[model samples]
Target: MQIQDLPYPDPGVPDARSGPRFLWWLFRNQLGGQVRSLAWGLVHFLSVSALPFCVGYAVQAVVDRSGTRLALAGGLLALACAGNAIGDTFLHRAAITNWITAAARVQQLLARKAATLGSALTRRVAAGEVVAVSTGDVEKIGWFVEAVSRFTAAALTILFVCVGLVVYQPSLGVVVAVGLPVLALAVLPLLPRATRRADFQREKAGRATELASDTVAGLRVLRGIGGEELFLDRYRSASQEVRHAAVRSARMWSLISAIQVLLPGLLLIAVVWHGVGLAREGRISVGELVTVYSSVMVMTYPLRHFEEIAMAYSFSRPSARRAARVLSLRRATSEDGSQAGTAPKGDLYDPATGLLAPTGRFTAVVCGDPDAAGRLAERLGGHPSSTEEEPSVLLGGVPLDELPLSAARTAVLVQDKDPVLLSGTLRELLDVPASGDVDAREALTAAQCEDVLAALVQGSLGAEDPLDARITERGRSLSGGQRQRLALARSLFTDPEVLVLDEPTSAVDSHTEARVAEGVRELRAGRTTVVFTSSPLLLDRADRVVLVHEGEVVAVGVHRDLVHKEPRYRAVVTRETEPEPEEPHDLQELEELEEIEETA
Candidate 1:
């Protein structure tokens, strides 16, 4: 596959059984490109290696004083140089194509997995690890894949040169043939130590990356709590640890490099020493001695491939393992068993906790535990839970998990307590796949997002429309309340058959919360809306209020009725006791005051 043909029509499922297996799968998928690279690489290396032979022949021709022989050698030298140039150019092109395509394939696989797993992905894997894998790890994997063809060509070149030498001169050829293998294998013992140190470095680096990610994500919270310095110190320590590990790994690899150079240098000396003795004994010509020396020198270039391939494998192994682990993750809902192109319409029901949200009504869920409330919200939307045996929520008496993911998502939408706004223009943020009569303007009005619009205008070009104003990543530039309102506006704009909101107004004031509650009730009048909240302003607007205590429905009624009768509900919502009424004034004191006024 070429770079222009990128973003493959079908990236195909990866073989994530094991790290090595995954690497093998990638190589197999790109076999055509790899072969092309190998072929060109072979041409290049062979032409370069043949140059020494051409020079030796030219020397011999000069010694013989034959004009025709000298012309032949010159022609052959020019041909070899031309071949080398063409091979080198094509080899580079093929290698780059192989690298980019391989990386793109892996990246596509990762993106597919991430889309399937959704929010649960971060829970299973660290955010920083995911970042590292998708970025640095992907490059490492591509490096290894691209190295394979070159390494193969180098090995073949070494073999061809050795055979040619043996045919031309046995005494020097034997020395070279024996020494080349020793040079390649001599560094094998040091590899284990090098690999161990590399693994250590990678581990420490992952931790450091994770620490930095966490610190950056929570920088605002840390500043609020006066703990920024503490986190900075922690990150500093992690970075130091990573640096130390990297230095140690570099030391080991440096030793391996030294060995690579030293062994080849020793072999070169031996080949030259042996060839000189053969020349002195009149066993071979001076041209043969020069050829042998040049051949040994050329062998050094190919021998280095062994070390390079080793380093590439050592680094890429762990990267591939991480990528495999991510790809191996399976969603709670089985994709194979999902019923395709089906969208169920009716009341949302979670069998796990017996929480039922009836059709065409605003139902409020009051759960004492916020985590439980969040889980219930996710369940209500047919989002896959972490459990295995627990059945998914149902829509219109059909298990939502059985429906295809796209259909399920279209039918029901869930907005979490902390929803994110992707970096883009305001219009782009609201550009979701939505149906029904709702639009951006109406949803914004219902969400009481006038302040958000004004903030956007003030933050950007004053003449620009609010919809055209840009929003920073995660809506970081906006205040918490503004961000929450914007998220609510986005969800409302979608206007799904069923909407599950988890504390949609938790950040807003009571007055704005009341307006938002009323607006939602009016806008979603004939749709199924489930709001998970404990605020009285929001609860008062619900057609039916259900209290979830200890993972089950404990009470169901209007918010006012529940507060009056259920002390637990009252405690959870208001978090205080009700005050008693005072007694009336005495009647005798009123009568005495009336008689005194009559006497006067």
Candidate 2:
């Protein structure tokens, strides 16, 4: 495959049972490639095993009485070396190819799963965890997968060497055959502790990554509230924890490396000592002794691979489990299975709040608690808007969960108060995904975005087309009101069957806000539109306003009608209208709500 076509692997199963299983499943699927690589590796390794024998033959010939025989043995040794070099080159390349492709496949699976789960993925798994899994974890899995072939090649070569030694010198061969097993199995006792340490280190690293992501995403708000220091301190603590875990993990690995080295060295020494004795007793010739020594020495190469495979697996198994958990997440709850792609053919209803938004009407949800109002809007659009409760939101008499994700999203579009201002031009921001189908000009007019268009034409830095002018990330360059208007324009452009707007005009001036409220009512005359706002101007425009108090709709009517009939609704809206000091009682809570709006 070409470099550009390299597939990104995304194996999202992160649970304990799923990690190894995912690898196994992938192995089964790619068994043919693996088998081909394995066959090549075996041939390469077998050819490589002839080097020590050739060296022994050359040594014996030089020690004996002939010049021509010595030259012939030397030539054979050179041929063996050349053969080994060629075999090793192809073996390494084939192994690496398998590793890279496997990693790419895993990454692809993960990306697919992330898209399938979308917003829900973050709600369940931390953003950092996903990032780490897609990057570092996948590489580790690939290492382990590739290590399998290396370990197999090493084991087979070692066995061949040991058997050859036994034929050359029975006494030394027996010593080697028995000692190799000891070196391979000796590290078993320490493996459990090493695996545990590696797992702990990985967990801390994931946490540190998550903390950094959160810090960066909230850097703007954190700076606004002067909480950067607090978050920085938290991040420092997380980093320190990761450092400690890494150090512990390093210590374990260092110890294992030492054992791997010492055990092989000791075995070599014992085998040599036994071979020397056999040679002195006249049971073995000098060339045979050299052959025995050479065989044991060559065996060290394979043993090292054995240890490497163990270490690779020690880290990868847990990482695979984490990836498995993410992939295993079902796209949607099965309870909503029957309702998917089917509609109830009536108005939408929320069971928890006892709020009903009739189909094809301009309804306003006025909540005394802004949090409650935001949550209500989320439920109406099929997102879990409640923290402690899963409110039931129905569309056309059918539950939102019952509708397929696409159907639900198409039927009801919740334009959050603070719409996400992606890095693009004002035109692109307003274009949205459905711009081609909807009338962009009409939507812009309804959203009162004439100023936005003027700014794009006059102030944009690049691209002559106003629609093509690029905006900065999060639209930080634009005023809050401009961003809100652009988001409103985008939502209106969708022309969804049900349009839910949460505090849609929070950043605009009263006059502009009045125009937007009126424009929205005029544009969505027959469609189901729910506006979550307490602005008297917007509320007055609502055909009917449902007053939400303590998570329940206590009163329902027009703005003036509710102010007269519901005392709590009047107080809440009045409080919001009144100007207060910069330090609001629930300042943090209010800021979070604003941030949520910005994300819409």
Q: How accurate is candidate 2 locally (lDDT)?
A: 0.78
User: Runs in model 1 with CA error above 4 Å?
Assistant: 336-339, 577-600
Please provide, for model 2 over 216-268, each residue's C-alpha lDDT reduced to its tens digit, 9 standing for 90 to 100: 86777898999999999999999999999999999998998899889888887
Poorest 10 consecutive residues of model 2 by lDDT? 331-340
lDDT of each: 0.88, 0.78
Clashes of each: 0, 32
Alpha-carbon shift of residue 374 in model 2 (angstroms): 4.0
Error of 2 at 511 (Å): 4.0
Candidate 2 error regions (>4 Å) = 1-17, 64-93, 331-346, 384-392, 416-436, 448-460, 476-481, 576-600
Candidate with best TM-score: 1
- Pairs that collide in candidate 1 are none
Determine the C-alpha RMSD for candidate 1 after optimal superposition of all C-alphas: 8.3
